[model samples]
Target chain A: MNRKEFIDQLKSSLSRLPQAEINEIIRDQEEYIQDAIQAGRSEENVIASLGDPKTIAASLNATTQIEKAVGATSLKQQAGHTFQAVFAMLALAPFNLIFVLGPFLGFAGLVFGGWVASSSIALSVVAVLIAFLFKFAFASAGIFSFLSMLLFLLGALGAATLALIAMYHISHFFLTSTIRYLRWNLKLAGITKN
Target chain B: MNSQFNKGVIEMCVLALVKQRDYYGYELVESISKRIEISEGTIYPILRRLTQEGYFETYLQESTEGPPRKYYRITTHGKKTAEDSVRDWKNFVTSVDSTIHSQEK
Candidate 1:
């Protein structure tokens, strides 16, 4: 196929990426191909270098997670996911603080949040303890006394907070990078065309 | 770092090309290669992905050059995205111009 036809096909395929991921993938390909051609490469040679599409697609997925971890989210998709996660965490923060910081000794609202938070933390700990001590059955902890919800919450708060922070950062980075990448890419493509 | 990274922008380029005029796969690839250095197979995934994402829709047309060739057309959403991204690019370039490129006040 001629180069235009090939790109048309490629463009069609690229549209399938998540709205947030569109630019990150497209600009990279356009630049790579442009550079290769400028260096006097043949069509057959260029195609060969790109390798299998399916394999490339799979590799792209792994990179996306990393992109997310590093504040790589794009501006356009700012409200997409990381924001959602942050909000969700914010909503849960009250619960998390209750168990970890307040530990059931507080106002009714704080105590209520603590109770729920402690229950969740207890469940996680119970699962881990069961997996090790019991016959390696993780879910069996379900049958155990949800009795020590207070202790479980206090114990697990540190781990949960850390996990939440990690999650928050990844989402924030990924969404921002995607937005920025698309913004710049679209502009570059536009300039060359005009 | 890789062609995969360019897939999103490439898709926009494809849509832009078609906005001016429709082209087949081989022709599209040729036109793009003239401007950029990329793997030939690279465009295929971008095409497939764009189609999946609904930016550009496709239909098969009989071709005199070879077998029925697939034709890709940019959808409304695709055009909007391309335009928006282009606008975003201008802001970035202007910033870079003042902050990094420009020396004289």
Candidate 2:
């Protein structure tokens, strides 16, 4: 391919990137081509040495997406960036639909299930304590009822506390592993520039 | 060399070269390709990433025969990273070399 054809192919492939970024990359390639020609190299040789535009575009897209993921300041932004990165990976191969998407969905489901289980446990504890208080308020005051109420409250509080602690750990593990997994996936897909 | 392994080493190589002196796109690619077989296009992405990571800075310089050229200079952070990477690479290579030599005995 000639320099113009090579640059055009690269530009089309990188259409997903922001305009500014796309321009910067194209300018860099243009400069490289100009310099190579100035150095007494043929345009054909320069293009040949540069290799395929599609592969170059793929690497560029991956770098841009990964940077977005890493630099995202908020959780919502991070999720968006991760989604973009995953889509970019999926674009590289169709089998990634099964290989990457299936495992990611499974992981998301596991995290969601763990969260729901912990939250329900905590919610049930609250419900039981509230019901016990209502019963105590209506019934005649008795040492036995008061003792039982005290025991029930203590048990409920302990269970709630344990559930909350478990939730914290589960969320922490989920957040860290999600980020690690995204980075690993990008690297495996040859999306990472280094 | 494996592309996976080359990706990391190439980052360091670019940083090391810039640590010596500023280089533009073609010069840098030519310098690196002299030693390592790589798709010349891949270096641009690496360069862009390193610059984004704050390891390198770019400025345009007027060329005698052309309009101008963008040059890349290593930042202080880039220098420190290069030093650390070089040290780690040395340690890793030495250990691997000794292990291989011993196994051959």
- TM-score of chain B taken alone, every candidate: 0.79, 0.95
lDDT of 1 by residue, B1-105 (tens): 344445456666777787666666667878886777665554654565455556788776764543455677888988887778777767877997888756665
* Top-lDDT candidate index: 2
After superposing candidate 2 on the true structure, give the runs of residues whose Cα lies further than 4 Å from its correct spot: A91-98, A109-176, A181-194, B2-5
TM-score of 2: 0.73
lDDT of 2 by residue, B7-53 (tens): 47788788889999999999999998887878787788778878887
Give, for candidate 1 chain A, the lowest lDDT window spanning 10 residues.
Answer: A185-194
Cα shift from native, residue B2, model 2 (Å): 4.3
Off by over 4 Å in 1: A1-54, A57-194, B1-8, B98-101
Q: Summarize candidate 2's per-residue lDDT along A99-144 as a digit string, tens digits.
A: 7677777776786787788778878778878887888789878978
- Provide the TM-score for each candidate, comma-separated: 0.40, 0.73
